[model samples]
Structures are given as C-alpha cells and as structure tokens.
Target: MPQNIYVDSYTLESLSNDQNVCNACRHLYIKWKNENSELSSILDHFKNDMYELMNVQVQTEDSPRLTTEENPTLITTTNHQVVKLQLNAASSFHTKCCVCVENLRDHAAKITSQNRDFIFFSRNIWIPEGARCCSGHLINQLLLKEAVDQIKPFSIRYQELSSSDVQLLLNKAQNFVENGKKIFSFDDPRDLNDDEYRLLTRVSRDNFNDFVQTSSTIRPSCSRSIRTAVGIYLCKLRLGFGYVTHQYVIGRHTTAIARELMCGGDSTDTTIIIIDRTHLHIQKSRNNKFERKTFNLCKKRSLLKSMMIITTIGYVVACIGSFMFNFNNNDAGITKDILLRNTSNILSWLKEHDILAVDRGFRDSICVMEALGLEATIPSFLDGRRQFSAEEANESRCITKIRWVVEVANRCLKQFKYFANTIQNSSLVYLESDVNCLRSHQSLSTTYDKI
Candidate 1:
C-alpha cells in the first residue's frame, strides 16, 4: 500500500523540485497550477487528488488486432500449352495493324526485304520516307521501290560531294555576274561606262588623285592609292563592310585597296584620337623582331621607326610603337603617348562647358580631360574598409546613369551585323572607313539639330 502524501503550501515547491516526481502527479500539478486564485491554496487540493489516485490500483485493457482480406490471383494460358488450357478463350487479335501496334522490328524487316533506299519507322510501321498515304492502304513492295528510286539519286549526290565544296560552289553561283560573256578585267579603264565613271569620280573625289599618285610612285607589290581606296575604306569602316562585300560594292581587293587609302596624307578631320592605351587590342608576332624593340622599348628608343597614319576622321596621328606592343600581363600600363595625344586632340575639339564621363577603365584619361578644359566626371572606387559618404554616393550614381548614353551609342554603332559578328578582318582599313562614314552620317542625320 502507498502512503498518503498530502501536498501543503510548502510541500508543493518541495515536491516540484524533486527529480523523482511521478508523471500523473506532475501532469495534475501543471493543470491545477493555472486554475487557483492563490497558487498555494490550489497546491494542497492537487496534493489530495494525487494521494487519492495513488491509493487506488487502476487496471487497463489491451488493444485488439485488425483483420485484412486477401486478393484473388490471375490465371494466364501459354500459346504452346493450348491443349491443356480451356478451349473457349477471348480473341487475341486487335483491329489495328500488328506491324503498327507491336514493336518496329517486323516493319524494319519488311522494309529491308523490299530493298527500299530508306524507311520511316513510326508506331512499329515502316512507311516509305516520303510516303503520304492514308491509313487505309497497307505497306506495298512496289510503292516502296518507286520511293527508293526517287530518293537514291539525291542520297548518292549528297554522299559524293563534301559539304564545304558544295557551300563554296553555291556561294559562287549566287554572286551577281555583271556581263554574261565578259570576265572581270582590271587593266582596261575603258570597261567602265560613262555612268560608272561618273559614279567612281563622285565617290573618289576626295582622295582619287592622291591615291593615284601614291600607287604610281610605289612599286606594284606595295602600291595603294589613297583617293580611290579611301572611299572604299571609309565604306568598310563606316559599315563594317567585308572584303568580299566591298569588292562587290566598290570593285577592288579590299585589303590592297585599304592599304593604299591609309598611305594618303594624314590630316583627315574625321579621325578619332584615342587617349587611353587600355582600349587597343595589339597583335603579337615573333617573326618581326623590330616590332618588339619598337613596342617594348618605344619610350627609351628614340630611333625606333614609327608611322603617322591618317585615321578615317582625317586626323593625322602617329602609330606609336607603344600601341603596337603586346604586354605580357593583364595590368594596363599608363603609357604617356596616348594620354598626351588625347589631351591635345580634346583641348582642340572640346569646350569648357562640356561634360566628359568616363569609366574606371579610363582612370588615366581624366588627366587629359582636365588638361583639355573639359569637366571630367568619374565614379569613385569603393574601398571595402569604409562606406561612401552620401554626397559621393549620389554623385557617383548620377555619373553612372548619364554615362550609359555613351554605351548605348556604342551599341547602336555595333548594330550593323558584320561588325557585331565578324572579327575585323585584314581588309579592316576599308571596313573601318565604311563604318566611320555611316556613323558620321547617322550622327549628322539624328543629332545634328540638337548640336
């Protein structure tokens, strides 16, 4: 028998502190603790209940087991043991063609037996590759033979010709031939009619004589005329016009034509002078040892030969050795040549009120911008150690927002598919000119009124 434990005010806290308190008493105390006006008064009531429950020995009944019904098994008959199975059975045949309903193995075998050139297999049926019959007709050997005969010639031709040669021939065939009987003859100036001559004259007016003089003086191997070549080259630069495309447009070897145009007098107003060296992609060649000396040691080596090439914009600019040098590392060098050149050009071209926005890529370009008497605005670099001041953050955001206009302008210029898709080819001289012309025209047409 259990002793009667009456819980008094003091006994409650004492019993609560004990680790060995029974689960039923613990649960009863928790439920009674919240109901009392005074917790001390209810503690005694809970104690009496616990004592009563403890005194009585309660018995519990066990849970009953669940019953489950089993399913009936299916019986199947094999084709080989038909005599042992029931005589009466459901039909196995289906309304759809067995060749169409079953796997494609039977269809492929049937097609192969007919000696067809190719068979289209779908839904386990072999249809001639080009067949267009309704479901009403069954597969026939004679129809398959006719389809095979029709497809075999094309298949043989496809197998015999290489894809590259076929494409090349197709391209050659598509070109617009001028005169059906006459081949292209470069020697005879008389080949051009009066209208053609006038068109050439109109196009070549700016640099015709200059290019002619240059080509006459230079050896045939090195000859290029600026006047005739410049218009074509300008067409190339302004349009991202390709060599072959330029040949079609202006009738010249785009590469040779461009080189000739570049040889002309350098002071073209259309040339764009770049002040930052970081933007140019320089070509590296080990065979040209002198290129290394010119580019790598351009600053120190005064005797290094440099060429002054005229840009499409008609700016006479020196092609410094530094711009041609290939740097071994990714770190963009702060070369003085481009900065100095850009400074001079900007001072001449821009006014004090003009705003010049630049990216972090042109950190060095800011010096030139300031020297040219223009306002230079660039976003401040955020160092992780400290947060930006509110004013600085606002100013940076403003500059960034406005600077997007130039990026959009660049994107618009690249909208010409040739420039966006192809790398600037060897005929880049003419291509660049063509692109510049188109850009200049576009700028004049769209923004001239605003300016």
Candidate 2:
C-alpha cells in the first residue's frame, strides 16, 4: 500500500488508470504510498480534477474559406494597404534635385513638352539656357545673365548692321548652315583695300610690330652696342629661358647671361620677363672597358663573352641612369634655387612690405620672401587635416584673386606664335627672349600706371 507522490496532478491520474509513467515519478509515488497510504486516495481525487481542467475545451465551429472572386473587396483593401505603405516610404525618402533644388520626381513629371516649354521660355527652371537639368533645381540665373550679357554686345552689333550690309553679308553667307560651321571670305567692297578688309586679312595689332620686324627689308640693328645687351636682357626676361639656353642663343655663357639679367642696369619699363623651367634628360655613359675590345677568339665564343659582359654593364648603367634621370632628383633642390634667385629681386621690387601673392608651386619662395622682410600669400594645401586658420584661409583667397593677372599675362605672351609652340630653331631663342621682355615690360607698365 504505497502512497503516490505526484510531481503533477496529471501524473497521479495516469498512475491510478494503470497507464505507464516516468520511472523517477513512479519511484517517488511508490515511496510516498508506503510512507503514507492514506494520502493516495486524496492524490487520486486531486489528479482527476487536474486532468479535467487540462483537457477542458470550448466548442468551435469551422467557417468556409473565402475564394478570390467572392472576396473582391478584401483583395482591394489589401492592395490599397500595400500601395499606401509604398507611397509613404517614397514620400519620406524623396530628395530635392541638386541643380534646381526642387523635388526631383516633380521636376521629372514637369519635363514634358507643355511644362518644359513654359519653363524654358519663362526661365523659371533656373538652369542655363543650353543646360540640361531636372526641374527642381534653381537655374544658375547669374551665370546665364552673365553669358547673355557677354554675347549681348555681339548681338547688338549684328542688329546694328545696315540693311545693305546685311544683304551683302547674306549674299556672301554659305548655304546649308550646320552646327560648328564657319564661313570666312572677303566682303563685297567697292575699294580693293578697305580698312576693315585690310585689318581682317592683316596680322593682328599685337603681332603687327613683330611681323613687320621679321619681314622688314631694313634690319633694325641696335643703335648702340649697349642696346644689344639691353635687347638680349629683355629677350631673356621675356622668353623665360635659363642661363644655359640664354647663353647658347645670345652667344654668351651662363654667368654672363645671369649677370646681365640680375646685376645689369635697371630693367627698362618695356622689359617683360616670363620665367619657367623644363627638365633636360642626361643619358648614362657606357663602360669604356666593354666598349673597346680586341677581336682574337672564335666569332661565337667572342659574341657570347661580349653579350654576358654587355648585359652586366647594361644592368648597372640602367640602375645608375634611373637614379640620375629621375625627376625627383632635380626637383629636390630646384625650388630652393629658384626662390633664392627669383624671389629676392621680386620681393625687393615689391618694396619688401607689399603682399607677394603666389600659387602653390611657389610655397618655398614664401620662405625666401620672409627673409627679405616681405609677406608672401598662398593657398593652403588640402592635407586632410584640421581646418585652416582664418588668416591662412583669407590669404589663399587673396592669392587666387591676384593670380589671375599673372595668368592673363601668360596668355598674352602665348599669343606670340613663336612662344605658343615649342622652340625648334636657334632663331626662336631670340624671338622667345624678345617676347618675354615685351610681356614683362607691358605688365609692369600697366601695373605701374594703375598704381
């Protein structure tokens, strides 16, 4: 008569029904039954109540599943929910167009003929006339206005043409006009040499003097021997040549050329110097021992021996050659040299107090200016570090503004065809030198007049 110890009331009921149960639970139940047989009947009743509670269920009736056609409204409701969710997501993520600053999709929708034409003529799209951009962008109104203003003069000139001039021009105009097409011909004129026609056909005013000097029957020799020196100095200044090139072309050595340009008499008002540099490649020499050899052995044997020796020599030479010829080798000390030579005079000319605005390439030159009691301004290098100081940032902007003048000067100098392309002949050396002097003088004179 063992009393059952029930871990759960359900286990007790299973045991009473003679159903198999876990050994651990059954063992515990048997021990309790032996210890307390009176409690076994109470446990059995408790088990019956627990089983009834666990097994209790409410009545549920099955409903028929709805078919697609029978529940059309439900289908539409689900579709609408999905569409709404997508629309909300899209609206949340919508971004403005970079060019127009308008909603990109809305802009896109307005790109049709009716909408596009209205915006195009109204100039409301805020884009350049020829510019292609989405609707939302604010057109570059200032840039468009500037461009139109620039071409406005030409347009006015076109409109100002007399009816007779227009008719004459129209008659001369080429048939079948297409994009990027140009027509150039002498206009119909009563006089054989009209001033306009001559001006059109003749060399430009800037180049007129140079052209005349080159083609003139009378060679304009220097009035004085000193004039030749002056001319040569001006030429060197204008044609941005080094001591070597100037010496070779001017029939003077490097020291002479340097002295004449640097220490010579005061640079004339007409003196224009354009200074720039180019790398000159120097080749490594072959081994003397390998280059000369006595031929005494068999042809094949000698050839093999020579090849081995030559290959070894070639490898060594190439290594040395690369080390010597590499641009980095020359670039190392060049900035220092240029700064020392050029900036000294330039700073002195600026009266040692005026700002020396220069580009990034002239960073080292700034140090030279500092030594000369001059302040140099240049753009800050974008080295991916912290922001530049206010002073440094302003200096950069100032330098950029002034640097445009130098750019214009360079462009003007390049207008000379001789300097526009690479110098090919010895004559170009003199021509280049002259051009530099002329440009420097022009720029200095212009600057001085402004001051």
Name the lDDT value of residue 215 in candidate 1: 63
Model 1 over residues 1-451: C-alpha lDDT tens digits?
0111222221423222123556676564454444322323322434443433332211101112311222112111111111111111111123322223333333332223222211211011223323232232222232322233232211111112222222232232222122322531222222333344333343332244345555644433345434335434444443321211312322221122222332233322222222222122223334466345334443432111122222222222222222233443211233234345652243344335344445575566566557755555567888784888898887777655433333333454456555455333244345433334323322221232233
Off by over 4 Å in 2: 1-335, 338-350, 386-391, 425-432, 444-451
lDDT of 1 at 106: 32
Residue runs of model 1 more than 4 Å from their true location after superposition: 1-339, 342-344, 412-438, 444-451
Taking all chains together, the TM-score of candidate 1 against the true structure is 0.29
**Tens-digit lDDT track for model 2 on 303-365?**
101000001001100000111222232322344454456522332233434334445755655
In order, what is each prediction's RMSD in angstroms? 30.7, 33.2
